[model samples]
Target: MKVLAAMSGGVDSAVAAARAVAAGHDVTGIHLALSRNPKSYRTGARGCCTIEDSNDARRAADVIGIPFYVWDLSDAFHEEVVEDFMAEYAAGRTPNPCLRCNEKIKFAAVLDRGMALGFDAVATGHYAQLRTGDDGMIEMHRALDHAKDQSYVLGVLTQEQLAHSLFPLGDTTKDVVRREAADRGLLVADKPDSHDICFIADGDNAGWLREKLGDRNPNTGGDIVDSATGEVLGHHEGTVGFTIGQRRGLRLGVPAPDGKPRFVLDIEPVSGTVSVGPRAGLQIDRITGIRPRWCGTVPEVLDGPAVTVQLRAHGAEHRAVVAVRPAGASSEGAPMGVASDGSGSGSVEIELLEPAEGIAPGQAAVIYDGSRVVGSATISGTGRSHALAQTLQRVAT
Candidate 1:
């Protein structure tokens, strides 16, 4: 097999590429140069594809004795991942940029280019397992190291992408992978794993967004209103500075009547309103998802054993019953009619058996049947449990 190994200058990817070579595959390594100005992104061990990272990848490739090259994906990455991140945040929604990068840049752009060059598959360091099911379709599953599993981010991949993808480190733990890297003489063996958004040089997301958005920012300042009282408790520099679950750094001048800490319940970008309330208001039992992407066969409905949905990249899974239908379909057994926001994409309605908290729109909801990924969808809306809604209503009255 001709494998195109994506070496990210990290221990996992270096070991993955090495393992691919040891398996007798004709492996060629490549590092994605995602930023046009490499210095603008994170440097040192905190970065993923910085200039230093590219050099590290090259060295790792040399150690593995494989042909290596750097692909300039800056333009594609900027339009797809970076722009999309700002746009999602501007619309008052929280998005996972890593998921977007995997969907648009890694699998879509890189895979297409690799196949054009006659490569059979593109392997990465992602900790997610792939297997052929009874139907002979490629099925993605959780990695052996549950703590390091990254299947949630890779959930956006389609059946075709999964077919041409290889994840060699999926069955191994992080410690073992690092040990293998050291044994194989890869220097990145001890490099700390990159955290936070790669493109953001500093971890301050709000400041970065404010500077990048500039004139396009909807509101320079807005009121942080209490949901229960509709009273303006404080003001914010921007609605993008807050997210659904945020409880700290609110700088609210007024305390809640109940004296309980308030969590951001909602963000209305157009109205410049950030609603705060008791944590109970954050509980939601239903999620409406758009742009459903299936890993293999698309099921009409998923229920019973192993049916679950993960809302965040590393968040716990919620046992759920999911129903798939065309966008704008009737709300039958689901909580609401799934709308595609005029994109005409398919929709997924997920009913969590147990309620989830602080679920925000624009986040990916990856559905699974036990270890195998069924599909994923972008969350568009959420609904509180009826009982909870009634309780809140009573409290309000």
Candidate 2:
């Protein structure tokens, strides 16, 4: 089989390509030049767009005895990933750019182009497994090393992509991948993995957005009201700057009467006010996910027993009961009275055993059943209504 391997100048991809070659597959390495200006990468940062990274990929390809090339996808990346990231934040939604990049650039654009150029499949350094089902359908499974699993970030992949996708390092731990690269005389063997978001090189996403979008005046400060009473207790620059369950940076001079620190209970971007309350106020029983997508065909209903739902990659999968919501009942805007079954519009509600915190709108909520990834959806909004108080009382008893 002819495979096109994505080498990011990282040890994981280096070992992955070597493993593919050892498996009797013809593999070639390609480093994506996602950034037009590679020199913009910081001195210490090992971002994907750096000249050093491209050189590392070429060297690794040479060590593995494979043809190597650099493909520039900067235009598509800027359009689909970077621009969308800034726009989502400007619209008061925290977007996951990594997930978007996987969906648009890695899977859609790169995979299509590679296949057109006569490559049978596209391989990557992702720590997720792909298996073929009895009916010839490709199924995506969790990586063997749960701590280093990257299935959540690749949740947006389509079933067709999974059929031709290769993840050689899925079953191997990070340490093992690094050791394999070292054994093969690869230079990035002991290099630390890059953890920052690739495009934002630095972690200043908000600052990057501000530079892209015109400098909108910092809106006047407003009261950080209590979620229960609408009573103004403190002032804040704007609610948009805050997320749902943020604990610190609430500049409220007075401590919560109970001695515990105040947590951001809610952020009302419309009123430009944030609501501060005790930590208990952030707990929620249920969450709604929108724009749902699954590797397999959508189920008629997701009700069987308790399943696992992941709000973010590298986070615990919470045990939850899944239900298909009527297409447009919850806010975040959809046509009302639409399909109640999961087949039509693909909206869902994963009712957790307890409330999960740090869940923000526009993030993905991926569901899993055992080791297999079931599906995922965007968090259109949250359900922090008056009913939460009654739910909390029930939990307390």
Candidate 3:
């Protein structure tokens, strides 16, 4: 099989490309130039796809004795991942850019181009396992190193995408991969893994958004109100500066009456109102997800003992029961009922057996059956736990 190795100028990806070579697959390496102005994005160890990263990828490809090229997908990346990030935040929702990158850029655009070039698959350094299931369809599972498992981000992949994808480092730990990189003479062996958003150079998300959004930003100095009392606690420059469950840097003029620190409970972008309250207000067990992407066969309902849902990339898994319905069906006042069949274009309703805190809309909810990834959905809305709602109501009274 001919494989296109996506070398990200990192130890993991270099080792992954090397492993693909070691596996005897006819491999070619390509580094995606995601940033139009490479210097605007992070440089050094904190960067993912800068010019330096492209050079590193090229050198790694040379060492591995594979044909290498750099694909400038900057326009596609800006329109898809970067633009989508700002828009989602402007609408008062937090988005996982990494997930979007994997969905729109890596697997979608890259895979399409690779197939056109006659490549059988696109391999990456992601720590997630792919197994051929009993049904003969490919199934994605968590990596052996749970601490480094990235299946949550890759959950957006579809059956077709999974069919043409490869993750060589999924079964191995990060330490082993680094050692393998050193053994293979890859220079990125001791390179620090990139953290935070790649496009944000200084890691100041709020400042970056403020500058980028400019006149279009809805968060131009709004009232920060206390949820319980409806009292204006302070003013904020923008709603974009706040996310659901943020507990710091609020800079409120008035402290909570009870002297307890408050968390951001909600952000209403249109009205530019950020509501702050106790952490308990952030507890939610019901999640409504839109734009569901199934890994393989779409399950009508998932209520098995091993059914679980991960709200965040590295967050704890919650025991959950999920029901699917058609996409345009009215979810308002709808009960969680098992659909006859879950179509690929349908939506999902997840009931967490245990409540999760600070679950914000626009985050991906990746469902898993044991170790197998069932699918993923972009979170559209969330409902507080019944008991928590009641308790809040009592407090209000």
Candidate 4:
């Protein structure tokens, strides 16, 4: 089989490309130059898309005796990943840039180009596995190392993308991958993993938005208020800096009546308000999500037993009961059921284990049935007792 490996010049990608070569497949290596100026971004020994990374990828291709090339994807990446990231933040939602890259740029653009170039499959360094089910549906599963599992981030992949995607490192641990690279004489055997987003070199997301969006709208000052009393606690620099469940970074000097630190409960961008409350106030039992996409497989619409739902990458996997809800009438009404008058949109209800904290609207909540990924959806809203009441009413009706 002919494969085009998306080499990011990282250890995992280099090793993946090498493994593909050793597996008797005809392989070609390509490094995506996502940044406009690759040299301007911090390459260090840890970052990807740096000049050093491109060179490392080229060298690895040489060692593996495969043809290597660099595809400049800066325009598409900036438009799709970077621009969409800023827009999400502007809308008061924390966007996952890596997930956007996987969905729009990597799987959509890069994979399309690979297919156009006559490649059989597009491979990557993602720590997730893909397999075909008895029903001919492609399924994604968690990596062998739970600590390094990245299936949550790749949940945005569509059915067609998974059909031609390859994750060679899925079955192997990081230690084993490094050992294999060393034995194969690859120079990137021990390269440090890229920690932060590749494009944002300094990790200052707010600063990046200010530079891109200008000081017109999203940066407008907002009042950080106490959720319990609706009293203005303090003024925040911007609402974009806060999320649904952040306990730290609130600079409000006012202490609680019991003298406890405050946690951010919600950020209302339109009202220019940031709501704060005690830690106990942060617990939420019910969550609703939108724009759901299964992991290359469509799920049964019937509500069944509880499944493991992942709220964030590297976060705790909690048991949750899920039921598919029908569309509601008004937008303000719960997106779950038919409006009291009977007219509107549908949504999914997630009953969480112990109230999950920091439940943001834009982030994804992926469901996993053991190693097999069930599906995922964009977290739309979270409710405490009220959200649970709505969930019950919607499903019962």
What CA root-mean-square deviation does each model show from the true structure?
3.7, 4.5, 3.6, 6.1
- For model 3, name the residue pairs that clash: 219-238, 221-237
Clashing pairs in 4: 245-358, 326-346, 327-345, 327-346, 328-344, 328-345, 329-343, 329-344
Candidate 2 weakest ten by summed lDDT: 335-344
Evaluate all candidate structures by whole-model CA lDDT and list the values in order. Answer: 0.90, 0.77, 0.90, 0.79
| Runs of candidate 2 exceeding 4 Å displacement | 41-47, 215-223, 233-240, 304-306, 325-345, 384-388, 391-397
- lDDT rank order: 1, 3, 4, 2
User: Residue by residue across 1-397, what tens digits does model 1's lDDT show?
Assistant: 9999998898889999999999899999999999999988787775396888998999999999999999999999999999999999999999999999999999989999999999999999999999999999899999999999999999988888999999999999999998998999999999999999999998899999999999999988899998877999999999889999899999998888879899999999998999999888898998999888888776789999789999999999999999987644455643233222112277888999988999999999999999999889999999977876787679767
lDDT for residue 83 in candidate 3, whole number 0-100? 97
Q: For residues 6-65, write the lDDT of model 3, one tens digit per residue.
A: 988888889989999999999999999999999988877653968888888899999999
TM-score of each: 0.94, 0.88, 0.95, 0.89
Error of 1 at 291 (Å): 0.5
Please write out the lDDT profile of model 4 over residues 3-22, one tens digit for every residue. Answer: 99999888899889988988
Q: Poorest 10 consecutive residues of model 1 by lDDT?
A: 335-344
Scored by Cα lDDT, where does model 4 land? 0.79
